[model samples]
Every structure is written in structure tokens, then in C-alpha cells.
Target: MKVFTALEAKNRFGKVIDAAQREPVTVTRQGRPSVVIVSAEEYERRQSRAWRNLLAVMEQTGRYAAEQGLTEEALDQLLADES
Candidate 1:
């Protein structure tokens, strides 16, 4: 990853975008990490993996809830609390 200050990244926006195509670029604000710019392909890959992981977790939770005989309203409340 390449680190760039927020001002530097703004001044050299094109370079930051170009670098992101090759690998992730870290943009910082006030010396703190603010965001990471990644290529479209990498972003899509990460999004897909996250979706899959969420589904797996939901499946496991559903199994556990089933074993506990959780009612629909209780499950809905549990999910609402998580949100």
C-alpha cells in the first residue's frame, strides 16, 4: 500500500487513481488513515467475499436459533438489535 496525505492525494488525484489500479493506496486526513483506494476488480472481489461470509454467518446463526427454538419475532428482534 502507498500512503498519501489528503492534500497530496487531492493535488495528485490522477497519480493516486493510477496507483490504485496496481494496488491499494491509503489516503490519510490529519495524519490518520481515512480511506483506501482499490482497483475495481479488487473491490468486487472483496465485496463478493464479504457477502459470502455474511451468508455463512447467517446460516450458522439460523442453525443455532433453530436448536434454541427461537420464534420469528424473537429472531427479528435479535437481528434488529444487531443492526
Candidate 2:
């Protein structure tokens, strides 16, 4: 990863973006790390993995709920109430 001060990143936005295409770029503010810039492909891959993990957790929870004789409608209502 390449580290760049916020001002430098702002001034050289194109270069930072180009670097992100190859690997992640870290942006710092006030000598502290602030943000990371990643390529779209990397972002999509991470998002897909997150969704897969979330689905696995949901499947496990659903199995447990089913074994407890919980109904789908009741689960939907409970989730809606929380929202």
C-alpha cells in the first residue's frame, strides 16, 4: 500500500487512483491514517465475500429458528419490528 497525506492525495487524485488500480492506497490526515482507496474490482470482491458470509450466518440462524418451531411470518414480523 502507498500512503499519502490528504493534501497530496487531493492534489494528485489521478495518480492516487491509478495506484489504487494496482493496490490499495492509504490517505492520512494530521499524521493519522484516515481512509483507504481501492480499485472497483477489489471493492466488488470484498462486497461479494461479505454477502456470502452474511448468507451463511442467516442460514444457520434460520435452521436454529426452525428447530425451535419458529414460523417464517413470525420471524418477518420480529425483524420488521426491530427496523
The per-residue C-alpha lDDT of model 1 at residue 29 equals: 97
> Could you give candidate 2's per-residue lDDT for residues 54-75 as a string of tens digits?
9999999989989998998998
lDDT of 1 by residue, 1-83 (tens): 99999999999999999999999999999999999999999999999999999999999998997899998998789899998
Error of 1 at 36 (Å): 1.4
Q: All candidates' TM-scores? A: 0.73, 0.80
lDDT of residue 34 for candidate 2: 100
Error of 1 at 14 (Å): 1.2
- Number of the top TM-score candidate: 2
